[model samples]
Target: MTDKNPDKGFVALLGWSLNAIEAVDRFDRRYVVVAPPWAEDYCRQNDIPFVPWDFDRLNERSHELALTLEDMGVDVAIPIFEETVEWAGAVNAVLLKNPRLLGQAMLFRDKSLMKRRAQLGGIRVGVFEEAHDRGDVIRFLKRVNQTLLKLDGDPNDPIHFKAFDKSGTAGHRVIRTPEDVDNIPDEEFPALLESHLDGWEFAVEAWIKNGKIEFLNISEYVTLGYSVFVPATPELEAHRERITEEIEKLIEVFDIDFGFIHPEYFLTSDNKLYFGEVAYRPPGFNALELIERAYGFNGYQGLVLAFDPKTTQEELDAFFPKEVVDAKGHAGCFGVYPRRRVVSRLQVPEETANHPYFEFHELSDPREQKVAKRSAFGTHWGLAYFFGDNAHDLRDLLKRQEELDYYV
Candidate 1:
């Protein structure tokens, strides 16, 4: 059967995920976008067609969107938000019902399922126990305590702690004591009690197409914080080949399809690698651009292409280079506004903007009102993107930007 659709072209659903959609824009094909309602004006200005869709409500909204787009015969539905992962199953349901659709979505939301599936396929991940409250926490902590505690130790020996759940960083906490254990709120804790990895962090970036894993790059996390990602050095680099092989195994075992994945891991002092976490989307850092800088192909753009049936994975892989992609200069990093807080103003001197190292910057208008932070949901108030041939220059500029306080 020939894969040709004269009437139905490609359609892409994007939320506030500007980078992913913009990356998709690099392709020659036309894209019909289903995005946040707020994006309508931006779409109009950019000459991209806009369809209203709420990324917040996945089951209902996505199912509704699936049906609506079914009529339009969209070839692809890609989500930019981590939250939209809930729609993965729903979209899969629709895709299964209609096999013509390009991909399947599963294990994208629940971290436990994601890890369990990966481990069964030989993926090296952290040892995690799913816990509910004090009982679960206590039981799991006891196990960790027994394993780590030394003989003739103090009766009140402190225990290092970590956690796992659906939420990122928020789902994790450092538990130092029994008292600290109790501090874990019932509502906030979902899956808990994970043994902390002592080694440095590395991220395996890949694209799974037709059950094939294309290992793009392994990124080491130099500095991790509220909103910063620095690169890892060669010494810090961990099991790139093993991780890639295992991930490929998981893709087949799980039956995942054309999509971008970021699998995080930690290497022990002995060089033993442990899985940390995985995101079904692109890297939080503009790691794609960095990868592209190192390799001629665009990692983010390849992700977008994976959604289009006309674009084959082989074609995408051919475009990527064999060597590790690196930033041109020494040390550099990127940061988001601290927390969910609003960006009252992102004050950057014009000099910084004109700098060759300064790749991009974004700011939320503080204006008359304060930037809101603690809400269950809100977009980034401001973002500052920096890129320099010299990593040191980028680092220095970030240091200067960090000193300025947000008014709200």
Candidate 2:
């Protein structure tokens, strides 16, 4: 076990993530991993402080874990994944003696509720509604297209279907026509549907303290769910002031005081910024790692500092570096999904491997010869990393990867 400052907050991390665990292991603040029982043996071997608990849906038994952590003198609970966000809130509400925290976490978990809350707070958002079945989805698609006055021959504007609680693109699908609605499985019903916003989509990572923004980094996406780079290009960077204001508004609306927030936004051609959705935990696609690569700082440690009530202004001020100015270079990653229907092996294209920006990849050999049909935004096989001094070159390099074959 690493030495910890007894005076600092003792946090309960309500999920298992190696990156987060490694960060807390080296930081001053003490933490305990509250994960499923499967991790018990690993935690014991590694000497990691652990409390095993399955994060199933909350029930009457949920308070037992909260009381247990409170008895352990835990000051707060930090969620590392979407599944644990509600768990963290439930536990923190008991530990911090604030019941409202649970409600706030729900806003981060449920997309339908989140949009309603954002709209009530006067945040701009695209047209959206909850869908309970295929009929509901079809009706929504027709209504959205009709509202746009889309002619019968005109291509229907696509609408998005997303699971209320799943993270990333786990249960996301794009419905462009009535026939497309038939492809949705019955289990994926009770989802949130939204009109596709035509604009530049980007995600913001903000660390807040005392209802103020301490540090914010923009992650520019080359293609949604495919590639993203930190400390966005100059054109996107120029809107920092406007973006910051929107973040401040999010803080006010969400009543968020501390910890990290990963919220996505779309800047329309008209320059109007529309709120997408926000997650209370760290973003997927290795965004924190990319941020750490671009700026010489540990983002998971930043999460600890932000959540620790004992953290002082001097500590935060000294921790994060200047946004774009402090970045060493642009760090980006492209998620690789096999383009072909069947693949016998994983092959990194020579053009990709020879590129100056190419750093490395996480791809491995194929486990099977047949690749299944992808539903919605399916999972990527792995990611390829890159770094360069020029953002445009990095962006172009990432975009070009989509055309290359990574498997055969």
Tens-place lDDT digits, model 1, residues 105-197: 446566767778777877676667777667776776667667776454445333333334243454455664667677666676566456666
Q: What is each predicted model's overall lDDT from 0 to 1?
A: 0.58, 0.93
The alpha-carbon deviation from the true structure for residue 270 of candidate 2, after best TM-score superposition, in angstroms, is 0.7
Model 1, backbone clash pairs (residues 3+ apart or across chains), number = 6
Candidate 2 backbone collisions, by pair: none
Tens-place lDDT per residue, model 2, 241-270, is: 999999999999999988899999999999
Q: Assess every candidate by TM-score.
A: 0.75, 0.98
Task: State in Å the error of residue 98, model 1.
Answer: 7.2
Cα distance off (Å), candidate 2, residue 224: 0.7
Clash count, one per candidate: 6, 0
Worst 10 residues of 2 by lDDT: 54-63
